[model samples]
Target chain A: MPRKAADEIVIALAGQPNCGKSTLFNAVAGFKVDVGNFAGTSVAFAETRVTFHGRKIRLIDLPGTYSISSHDLAEKVARDFLLSGEVDALINVVDASMLSRSLEFSVQLTEMRVPMVMCLNMMDEAQRKGMEIDTSRLEELLGIPVRTAVAVVGTGIDEVFRQAIRVAGGVVPAVEPRYDNDIEQALSRLLAVYPQALKDALPLSERFVALRLLEKDEDFERKVGASSPDFLARASEERHRLAEREGRAETLALGSHRHGLVLDLYEKVVRHRRGNVLGTREKVDRFIIHPIGGAITVVGSLLITFFLAFFLGNAIAGLVDVPFGALRASIQAMPKGMGPAVLIGLFEGVVAGAGIVLPYLVPLLVLLAIFEDTGLLPRIAFMVDGILHRVGLHGSSVVPLILGFGCNVPSIMATRTLENPRDRFVTMMVAPFVTCSARSVVIIALAGKYLGVLATVALYLFGGLMSMAVSYSLTRSKKRKSLGVIMEVPPLRQPYPRIVVRKVWLRLREFVLVAWPVLIVSSLALSLLSYAGADATINGLLSPLTTSVLQLPAAVGIPLFLGLFRKELTLIMLGAALGTDAIGNVLSNGQILVLVVFTMLYVPCVATLAAQWREGGFKTAAASALLNLGVSIAVAGAVARFVGAA
Target chain B: MEGETAAIHALHSDGATRKRIQSLGLFEGRRICVVARAPFSGPLLVEDVATGARVMIARDLAENIEMESRAPEGR
Candidate 1:
């Protein structure tokens, strides 16, 4: 076979959440990616190259969205890429079971003036639900090539892409939405104001821009208004003129009119059975969401995932200690001070990287993958939505919060799926306070050993409560975020190994690619700081707080300082500094409690700091670190003074 | 109106919220099956029968919005 050029034709897979676009992409690309019943599981858009109809094409799977409206991230990602116009064609995936809602977006795509092949996906589910869609009638109505598939089962998938390729090869005219004469006249009047050269530079078709202008989309105002503020003023006038003719808000009038056309199209091609065929799924939902059973099920799952990951991580981590410790001893015994420091620092990074971190991180990520793949997590998110809303988070934000227990970096990555930046910021800010697995280990080693297991659980519960309280306080600002939610409640299904493995792989890949480098480098860097004769100065600076205020030995100061790079080091360094294996011999119960509080609450681990910086930017990340410092000192001091050590 | 269907007369929300609600298939004149109303003026668990997609609306918004009974049982 002859080699194809490297200029692969870019084709996009677009659809609403849970439409199985990922599954179809997985099937065609001969690769696996996350598949989940709920929304936002595929947090980022990714591309894979495949040969379709003897031509190589790059298939990009985008985050799910209902429409091209840029109110949310998913919409922004999809529409931004589409309007870039680099994509040769779009595989517009419509969930056959939810034809009316899905088609609402399909109409918007038609106006984009791009070649598109409509993938009427989930035909098996639609048939199972006693719904019927006439594909020929739909194709005729929308004037686009249509293909049907149950993508999860890999049925009719090849035909879908084949049609897509043919359509992309210039087989059909762009389907433009036809609105009322008055609106069209108003739109033309608005368009006449823009010079042809300027209009050509607009991201979307004149019709789409006109519709958005009528709707008064903020993004359009910002982009177009930059060069031509005069256009915006004229467009507003035209909208009101059209509204006066219709006797309603022009945006609403336009929406009602366009939706009427969609309903007309829907009526022509689709029919529904009188009875709901979702018997089994609904029955199971009733149990999982039953007020009492729901709480138990969610709570039980949390316990199982946390404890399983915790014990398993500890057990495997135990195996790494011998090898890592041996390596550490060999390095330390090799030479004099600086030599030992450099070698030990790098070795410590390695020990922390693979030995300490990965064991705990792996099990937690795998469990989270399973939770999302099975669709159980979103429902838990739904149940907590009411409470979490008090803190300016969506129900979907709960996914990141729960995963924070396992680790914070991946949880921070999970916030990408949240539509609103405010939600993402607030969630990211509060997530570190969720007390991660490493913190849990710290609490167990310190509080459980000294204060009792009850105290350990109490500290975890207290951390959770403080996070929520702080989050609620954060939402008290005057930013005016709407707390309303419109999240999907997907049926829980058994996770396919292929899909779940893909999710876990992508997550761990992120761990390796982004988080690990920072973890290792920061570990080495902090060690180099200690080697450069700064430990005494750092210990001296922290002495007042560690020795006097929170009532701990000056030795504890180094661990407190080092905990920022990797939190588990609070325990490891405390032992090293004291030169003893038995921690109980060095501190009182209340003193131990204060030390635990200090480590647990102060500055998030360096890996988490890196994640925060990457996601929330430097200002917010720095603000988070400073805030943690303040809160840790205040809370730890209060506890130490009130409890009074033996 | 507990078990009956009702048309969304107006969303009583701003431009973006209204448009988003429409994307969920709940536009003006669209029918919704009211599954259950939570106690203490909480969220309303409602379903769009046509799409078989359900949503929980905050009680505050649900109250301000006006709707007419679409089905004979609630009509």
Candidate 2:
């Protein structure tokens, strides 16, 4: 939306990836932004309004980007927002620990001539790194108000925003960073030849235009081409001459020029006190990233998370089961008629949702939040790159797969980080098999309750293997080698308990608001269907596969079939279908295992299918659904036969 | 590969990969140290000495970026 209020300051928080831009924005915006330690975590922009000193501040949290030149989707989102000319001021949040690299992006931002405040964020990290940044010196050099902040702890954030508001309200002209003589000369040459009218027509500064053209920024080049085709010819000729003189591509020359400038600037402002001693962070990081030790840490963490969720979920389930069981018995004892039956159906839905799902979901989300905040996901991605390569994927795919454990919708969206379409498609296709938290609810509640913890762990392992096998087969015919991963491994930070709780509540709120309503309505709808005796038809129709092939009860057909809408429905509606919440009494251990496997492998829920359609197009989504159904039948059938044999 | 500083010779990649590499501050002439190398040819974790930015470069991409190793600097 365009700024309707002239007094409203539209300030955007911009920075390099994993530099705490979101954290700072969250600090001011009251936890509206998603803060994760992984780069590219903020794929989209988040905007909120704050009343700072009675002045409305429209705060925008942009996706972290290393440079405006890259065409990655996340970077594109950030670049588009910046170039949109709507931002009144920018908060260039720099990771003070990595001052030089962060300065490169800050330098790039200055070229836009936007009123900006330099926020030396993560001051604690810099201090821990034994580096002291002279903020005043940085302010003096950059000609902008610079503030130091440890955003995580809420240190210096209000002052940083105050500085930004002052910078926006006042005439604080952006100080253009100067480059080496060669780049300056080249830039001047290009600007001198460029038409004044055309330069003024563009939203960016004339110098930024010249630099972008020389650096071959496609979006800028296209804009300039649309304005004046004649200027493009001159720019390319100048670019060629500069590339020849630099003995490299014009893009590389521009980047190196900035690199040299930033290094020189770094030496001027940063003082290293604890010279060369690896801090405890680096020491622990080394052990964590070690091949053997890292493997142990990674595997052990997963096992611990699984067991904790299993036991904790069971305990919660047990606590709630007593009250829900009494409620069910009271409803059943009311009468042996349709009214009581339907009442029991509605009651069972609430029981399954509140008692069964939340028990497992709450602990799992808490752990996932801890994992995300701790910055371990990227390391896992790095460690698994080689293994993924065997399946025609790479480390980048691991992010989406790991995220899939929480839910599939965002996980599919996370595939935007993968550059290759083939990689994205394969990852999207394989990701749904990763057993999202909703599926985990079913697996834990049913499998954990009846089959034991090892059986549940084995089932999760089986899902992982199936995902790998499916991805391998999907890419077997395509011989194009996957691109190697180039990902930033952000420093691990202690997970703040408050933020973790907030994050879990955000996810849990979704289940309460969206999924619970659907659960209750669907439960009621199924009850009505059974009242009309239509569920018998659904169960009978699916019985050919559910009963004959999987050797499960026909009544389970309704839950299994309706589960395509929400995986939890299969478990929620199970008691309603089978006439009892005590599932072990009716279904044996082997039968529950077969049902879990089938539910896990079946077509992803409606939300997931919609996400797949949006991300991979109709054909990919349809093919995926078919592939899932095919795999579920085949695998579940085999499990049933094997169980029978045993 | 560990405890060595290397000046990047060149990135023998074109298009997006090269752009991504350069964007991450892995430009030619920058010195970097291999901090960790995962087993089974996973990825090499390299820290740019000048910037203190650690990047995980997959072995294939690492193979393409030529560099000349030097002895570890004295503390």
Candidate 3:
């Protein structure tokens, strides 16, 4: 099996987690790549073309991994790419300050004999810490070019391209790391038994596989077995013999041996400063983390965020309502015809869902981006670490919980950051129960029409308490051990206006695109059902649950059911069902409070249900929806009973 | 105790250990100052002389760390 000639250069950008690899990729690529599903899998990959020396270069930003060992999905993706032999060169991004750990991966790549160059990123931070590395010596030891970079500040970018082009052009030879004599002898013995074809196809040197086999890496065994099962078994026996002679696991010995060499090389080349310096970040942290000061700041920030979201949403809703009102009035003027009613109803649903709700979500997402960009979210996470621990989650879960207030889909998606499976699952399950902006519209409209603004706020508080109680009870019953929050709190910088706006617009655009179609279809369906006298039949069935148990009119259940498709449609449906004036006369203040509470705790919108299934699987999704329905019914029933008695 | 500060000792136990220290700017021949310590056994505020940046680290994490104070030698 002969290999295909490299028609296009495939370069892999590899690094350890949180080492500024993504930042560097974003800086270099800058929206030039098509971001979508990677080939056949749902996993996303960004593909872009850059004209380097007049030749198009294809760059693949591989998932960041700690090592090539297949312990996780990220590691498997990275290791498979490296072993594929399809890539022409590798751009190994290393954090200068965290060189030693970065170097361990670099050593593994060097053993693969891949045409590679090292990008020592974060030079600014490294220099600030008063550390200097002798790049020349490092290059000599690793047998590859080493380029220093401060990626965020856009330094050494040209050098990165220059080295990449050189490697791609075959102007530079792959560098091989010098291993210990014992390992070298064993590798040569192992290679002697390998078939010529197998030897040529593998990207890494025979020695690297021999070392991995000694370590008993399961993935390595499977890979070797694919080529020669007999050879792999023989190699395992040899590894056992070597481990007994060495009086240790051959893997641990190999790691120590590599560390020893990296240390020897670093000793001669690295220099550092003596004492620490006082910086501005420390001064700011004092005020932000102060028990009293932190509380004030947190409250103030949250209030401002909510106020901006509410005011902006109200303004946008006012602007959108003018056309909708006119369109409805025109349809009513036409001789009460079925066609006019159906067209007008569909228009109302789209207007309510997309025009009114999505615009409001934009400003809120923008405010969230400001908080995330300025690094205030992590500080807030720190402040709530104590409370979060009590609920079987770490402080990091706060981000997703906060995001739930904006939209539950992304909030559930954000749960991927949590390491523990149980924590992620529980957070995703409960996030939709946190009344989002869509629910706010229903609460406000009902409160304004029947109750008042004060009652609306009180109902919101009640909803929040219910969400917390459910979260606590579920977590406690599960008996999940609280994991400590180990997060990197990035330095606070002024938010980038362009990036913030782009992120906000992107999210808002998704809301409009997905929500508008569903809303319009739901509105049309409801209108037809009403015209056909189906509402009466549905209300007759709903009377037991709404009128008897919840002590509300059967008419209210139609809108509540429609609310599951689009939340703002609940208000619109209620408006059409009860009319503006009749709603006030029909439902008393106590009944209105019951309605608002039930609506807040009821099943999430259809889009959110789809997101739930995607994030939490079918069982969790079905269970979450059923739980919401059960809780809404019980709470509404109890509240209605108490209010009727009072 | 004063004379012992000037004595040459094996400051770093091993290479892997030394690399971890170096990456965090707490390498051999580097100076570190404890700017502030939290009440009880909370987080510590420390400054790195090389970069002049102060960082807050948990006290428990700090306990596993070893540092050489270069302040004994007059700057």
Candidate 4:
């Protein structure tokens, strides 16, 4: 489609993975994107409007990609947008610390010939590595405006945007990258054979198309082949000629050729003086990544996060309980009828929301954010790959699985990084069973409240085991295993308190805005239903399973039904349904355990199901619901039997 | 293979995996070091000696990538 805002200048921030593009984007766009140390954190582009230098600027943070070669969906998203020609100006953010690899990507960006400026981000990182870069030299070398920025500290951020604004307003002087003489001849030869029809059809510049074609980019090759198979044939011949000269695949030959130029440029511009770097961090990793120690650290850190959130949430819950109880007593004193019931419904909704938000959701999100920002998630992924592989998952699958604990929506979304459709399907299928924070609230409030901490932990372990079993069963029939994980382990960084707070707020706000309102409205509706004596019919209808199989109180039917709306509602609505927020008053310990287990593994919340539908269509979503229903029934039934036997 | 430097000789993996690895700057003839390995046949942390960038390659993929032993380039 055409550009929506004709008058506004559209600038896009693009860079390789974890090179601080989101950091720089947020610096100017004011926290429109999530910034994390993990690669592929921003799986989708984030866009915002800003009035910069007295001009209406639409700035977009594209997903960070290693190259425009488009190996996976993230890279394809970035490449397609950049080549869409909608970006009026581009900010190529490069990590000053990883200058050589970053510059290799910068070299590819220059090939696009868009109006661009280079932002040398993380200059402090480079300084720590003892690499002093000559910005002027880089500017002269790349023939574009270059600026230095430490985005975390807000240093040189505005100057980077100022340069981008200037460059967008003016002409981008064409700066073509020159390769070695032979490869240059080969590229021109391939370009000469490029069809005029294809040239206009393809959005990329002719030289870039030629280079990517030479590199055997699948997307470009298909595009070119569709336009002119004869051109593809001729291009293959030219590739063979170059391969003959280089004695390797033409793709690698071109890649190595570009790397040679980038290394040359890097040497000319970067002066490396000795500095103490990586000593302490490496020593630390030696233990953190040790065969035995790494496993312990992973399990230990996760347990610590769990117990901390659990006890901390319980403590906060205790503090909030007295006020809510006092409010309830006053409401009870007012009257006993429909109006009082509705008032109590609304009040209890707020109380239940506060109960979950303060006690469970907030603490959990904060801890998850800390794990994410500290760059520890990938390490956990690395450690868990072997175990996950036994269940037919790649190591990088751990990222999404861990994120599933926060919410299933982003967890399903994060599966985009996995290139294989089967891998993504398997991950998504198990994601809902991963005990999201909302479900954790149900488990902790019900099981932890009465059944004790051991029961809560056991419930979590059972959920995890069920998810693994599901993944294994799904992948066992497939003949091919998932392609092995190849992920960049970003350098560990100190989690910035500011960023962590924003990240937690971003997640917590979802609970407050989306889930809390749902909680309130559902509580009110359930109260109205109970006040109208309609819940008896709904509860009677579901009694076959809830009453007979799971052996829970029939009043739990509405809560379990509405729990499909939001898992936390199972806990929140339980108070409204049972006529008391103190669930233990109604439920025996085994009954609560059965209820939490059924709630934990049953059909995911509506938002999660919607996300599943979006990611994998209706069939996958149906599979998830069916899978959860079947598993929850089977397992909870066994638990009910076992608890009764015990 | 921990803490040993080697030159990448051949990438015997299939198209997509090879492309993914190469996109991160791993290529034939470039020297890389095995920085760390996870237990029970997990991924290995490999670093490019030239760029100082680290990536975790699954043991399966690492197996397909033939690495010739090389003397460590003095740090």
Give candidate 4 misplaced runs (Cα > 4 Å): A190-204, A222-233, B71-75
Cα lDDT for residue A291, candidate 1: 58
Question: What 10-residue stretch in candidate 2 chain A is worst by lDDT?
Answer: A167-176
For model 3 chain A, the run of ten residues with the poorest summed lDDT = A34-43
Best-first order by lDDT: 2, 4, 1, 3
Model 3, position A393, has a per-residue lDDT of 51
True contacts kept of each: 0.33, 0.80, 0.00, 0.79
**Residues A1-646 of candidate 4: C-alpha lDDT, one tens digit per residue:** 3365777998989888888888777777774567767777777778888998898998888888888876677777787887776788999999988888888888888887788999999898788777889999899889899999998878998888888888884557356778889779988787777788887777667888888877778888898888888888877777778788868876676877887888889899998876466677666666777878898989898798789878998999999988889888999788668998789889988988886556888888888888888778888888888888888876778889988988988899888888888888889998999999888888887788898898889888988898889888988999986778889988777778887888888777777888788888888888888888899999999999998889888888999999888888888888778877777888878888888889988999999899999999999999999999998999998889888788
Positional deviation of residue A491's Cα in model 4 after best superposition, in angstroms: 0.4
DockQ for candidate 2: 0.75
Check candidate 2 and list the clashing pairs: none
Residues A1-646, model 3: lDDT tens digits: 1343346577778876546665567667774432211011112345555666665677777766656765555667777777777777888888787675567778877776677889999787666656788998888888888999977667897788789878864533345666778766766777788655556555466777777786577788887888778778877877776677766554444655665566666676678764553357546766776656667777777667656656676677678777777776776677756896687667667666755566566666777778765667656655655555555554457767776776777677667656678887778767878878778666655674457546756776787678777778778877556443334444454566655664566566665776667677777877778777898888888889889988988887788878887787777677566643246787888888888888888888888889889877888888889889899999988999899999
Candidate 1 RMSD computed on C-alpha atoms after optimal superposition onto the true structure: 5.0
Worst 10 residues of 4 chain A by lDDT: A169-178
Each prediction's DockQ? 0.47, 0.75, 0.10, 0.75
Residue range B1-75, candidate 2, lDDT tens digits: 687787898888887889888778788888998999987788899998866778998887888898965547834
Q: Kindly report which residue stretches of model 2 are placed more than 4 angstroms away from their true locations once superposed.
A: A1-7, A169-174, A275-277, A337-342, A644-646, B69-75
Model 3: lDDT to the true structure: 0.67
